[model samples]
Target: MPYPDEAVGFMADGPESFGTFTKRAYKLKPFEEFDIDVKVEACGICGSDVHTVSGGWGEQLFPLCCGHEIVGTAVRVGPKVTTIKEGQRVGIGAQAYSCGECKQCRNGNENYCPVNSINTYGSKWPDTGIVSQGGYGSHVRAHEHWVFPIPEALETTNVAPMLCAGLTAFSRWYATVPGRGRRLALGAETWAISRSRAKEADAKKLGADGYIATAEEGWEKPHLTSFDLIVNCANSSKGFDLPRYLSMMDVHGRWISVGLPEEEGQVIKAQNLISNGVLIGATHIGNRQEMLAMLKLAAEKGLRSYVEEIQIGEEGLKQAMQRMKKGDVRYRFILTGYDKHFARDLKI
Candidate 1:
């Protein structure tokens, strides 16, 4: 299939008001080496989308398109692309390109590539200097490295958010610990995903064997069981007292921080962890192999992302972002209706 000259996408004029999202037609440049054009079937609404469009994180490039968890069929592939051919079902996530020769890339840690690491949206191509648009559009074009073949067992609608949320959670969970094909952990330690009391059911629905209600004022509740691993996914560390939480950890407990707090710097005293030998580590998105493994595990186990689907349009996309800002969605949101909304009459 030939590439469309232009693509229509929902774009916000500025960060001042993301509710002002409107459909706009933007010209598509020719596919470059290792690029694949995907006719987007579904795209997930991630918290990053809200932060980028709402100016909460920072001022972004105006008229920005911001969906990253994209699942689609490949409509076009760059001439130099060899591994992936057209018509393949695939997914694209947050990080786009990383210098292949870098040590991080060589070690299969491309997400940490120090040179030329670019995002799926709001990033520029180092060579062409063209800005990268995301999947809140008819289609998306990305380098092969950031794209992965979607497992056949997964539904596009359900698996879309896995490209981001699943990858994020799996990377933190699976990176350090290796397990069997479906079993990710093998009796290592008792791990429970903590959440605000409001999301207690969601935490359980996501397969948490244990729950911790931390939303209570001063978190007046005490943990009955101590965990060896606690992955921090909180959006805010506003009143996060490191010592109080650290007190609940057993010796050699590791708190992996993956959440990006809107407000920076909740103090952590070294003494808090000294007695227990607790460790704090941070991670971003996962490497390519990890993404495939995550998808495979998800498929084999029939693990579906908890998502609410909304039509792909100005109102639907805009409200999804706004709802994410207010923590309205259960777990994730998927944008549907791109095929019908961007009909053949409209540029795609």
Candidate 2:
């Protein structure tokens, strides 16, 4: 297949407002055996994109294309790649690559690999010395290992958010399971709090037996001590009446914290875990195997993402970023309709 000469999208200079994704062109790297070139059909805008663009998560590479939750068709695949083929519907998550020889990779925990881990965009690839780019473009070149074939039943718009938001929730959910017959409670706030409910719905679709939402009024009254695991996805540092919540858990219940509060130096009381034998832990994103497992689950359960669509072009991307900053999207915003020239493909 013939590759395009250029791809365009929103480009960020530094921690600025949402008006910064200006029109620009990027050169596609020469093809490699492990690489796959995609004609982007849809790309989900995640909070991480906003954070990276605004410098909330620290320094970022300039002229960055920030979208990570990507969905599209494989237009070109490297000769060495066998898992994916040309013209296949596919998606890429936040992580782009990881050193495969590490203990984490060997154990199917590539997300926690001790060596180098490459993010989908705004990070550097140790092998090629190229600053990794993102999915907010007319086309993207990715390693075949990082890209997965999308299931036939799922729509691009609905599956885009699953690349990041759904995967994050799913990784946490899978880690929290204790045994075959165990109940779990998910505590979340802000957008993630709502995502937790969606996660539970997906879990239920996958045959999850129990999930209780703590966001509703009087939510704690009924679910306290009802769960064997409590997954914290909320950012509140005041602590959600931990003692009360822990009291409801069965003995040896586990408490996992995935949300980081805005303020630094926040501490947890030891008594909360010590008194009840509740295990407290946190996790990063999943590795390649876990990502495949997640996609398989989504395929099997017919999971869908509640995403808002934004056209992929100079003006639409700027507006989409503005709306995302204001928390206007339901779950996620996907940039779509990228033609040969990203700026010209504005129909969406």
Candidate 3:
């Protein structure tokens, strides 16, 4: 079978000016037996893309197209694949692949697989010797295992952000100690914090009895001693009084931080934990099992992602990235209007 020569979209070349992403083309890797080609219908813009392009995270490989929250139709499926047939509505999250034989993989924790764990973009594919591209382009070829079937009742745009941001929040919410009636206090910079009264909204969504927003003045004081768990999705480090916040948790409260702190060297004194019996931990992205479970929950609960739509053009992508940098999006942004040729051969 023949394949298209290239995909058209914006490509980032290290930390150059915003104009660097204009009118770029990237070569699509040769298809493999385990791959599923997707004609992208939507992709959510995420903060990680900005960090990668601006060199905020680290050195970035040039000629990269960064987007992970992808939703689309499976245009083609490899001969060896059986789970996802062509024409299936599907989505791919941040993680693209992992070595299936590793211990973490065996235990359903592919996100932490010790062997090569491929990211949706800006990461290398050890098996194919290709840099895994992303959903910013017209199409994406992902390993079948990473592709998830989008429920028939869900809209593509609404499900796009669930591929990353939604899943991140959901996974953390699910990991909290069950039956303890945990309360969540979201920090100020969380996307949820700024929109939708995050503390109360997420608390209700995650089955918490109550939540208090730390962003509002004097809101933190009344709720301090009422929570059993707190999840930090915001980027701030020093604004909150750590000792006081920790005291809010019950005797064995759990405090988990998911997003990176704005500044390095952010520290917490030992006395804070010692006096309050609070446990602090952090999480990376979800593994394959958690990813599947999250999708199931989203389907069952009618959970939807907040998203903005953008066209799949170079200028549109650049503008979307700029919006992401300024935190202008409500929760997520999904790219649409890609070429339709990739879906021509799909079979449902």
Candidate 4:
């Protein structure tokens, strides 16, 4: 299959001008036999994108095209590819490549493949200078192992963010077995904890059983030893109170962190986890099997993510990035209008 030599995207040259995207074309990496090229449709904006582009995480590959939550149609399939075909709808998550021979990959933990794991963006191919550009482009090329076939029942825009955000949410938890039931029981009560009460209404509206505002003093008193798990999605670790947050966890409860703020992470000392025997952990994006299971579950359950859509362009991207930094977006932002921004096939 014939593929384009270059792809156009809104590129960021440095952290100083991270939000200011300029339209430019970059050369595509050398395609291999197991690669698949996707025609861009909709891409999700993630906190990680903001952190990377702004140099919060660290120094990044300059002139980077940062977006990982990608959903599109397969336009070109290499001869070695078998599962995906041209015109099939697909999605690519944060990870694009992992050494399949590693222990993690062989055991269905490809996301943890420490050897030669390449991100969908801001990661360079080994022994080559070509950096991996992401979904914020006219097209993106990825290995077949990392490309997932989207379920027909799921909507493109709704499921786009799930590729990254949803996957992270999925693989971050470890539930304990109920002492009574032979089968896992349904209905685990979920509560939303925000820094303030501003989101209480919204959280309750979204089916949260209760809401806790940290701004209110003695907030964790009523809920002492109430939670079994806490998923920390905070964007920054600045001024994070570790002991207070852990106070709500029951014995043997876990705290899993999936957010990546550029700020230095809060240091966890032995005293912090000794009282409740809390387990603190973190994870990257989910593996290929988890991605497929997540999509299937979403389709069957008719799950919809709260998303705000913005057309792809310099101004739109700039506005989105600005709002993202301020926590202005409701939940997620999906970049649309690919056909209008890039002409058919992006013949540049």
List CA RMSD, all candidates.
3.1, 5.0, 4.8, 2.6
lDDT of 1 at 125: 72
Give the lowest summed-lDDT range of ten residues in model 3.
186-195
Candidate 2 residue pairs that clash: 225-248, 225-249
Residue 237 miss distance in model 3 (angstroms): 3.2
* Per-prediction TM-score: 0.90, 0.81, 0.84, 0.94
lDDT of 1 by residue, 1-348 (tens): 223766678887776676667777765545788888888889998878877777767777667778899998898888888868799999999987888998999988899899888888888777667677788888788889889999899999999988877788778455555331123363343335454566666666766665666655555246522556666877777777777677666577667777777786677778767877877776788989989988998899888878899998878876777788778887788999888987763632
For candidate 1, the clash count comes to: 0
**Rank by lDDT, descending?**
4, 1, 3, 2
Greater lDDT among 3 and 4 belongs to 4
Runs off by more than 4 Å, candidate 1: 1-3, 177-196, 216-225, 345-348
**lDDT score of model 4?**
0.85
lDDT of 4 by residue, 138-166 (tens): 88999999999999998889899999989
lDDT of 2: 0.70
TM-score: the better of candidates 3 and 4: 4
Global CA lDDT computed for model 1: 0.77
User: Tens-digit lDDT track for model 3 on 1-348?
Assistant: 224545555677778675357545566667889988887888888777777787777776667888898998898899999889999999998888788898888976777777988888877777556677788766788788889888787888888888887777666455543654333323221222232364466446645444455566765566555556666666547565667667766677667777665456356777778765778877667765567777787788787776677777766777787877776776677777665522432211
Could you tell me how far off, in angstroms, the CA of residue 77 lies in candidate 1 after the best superposition? 1.5
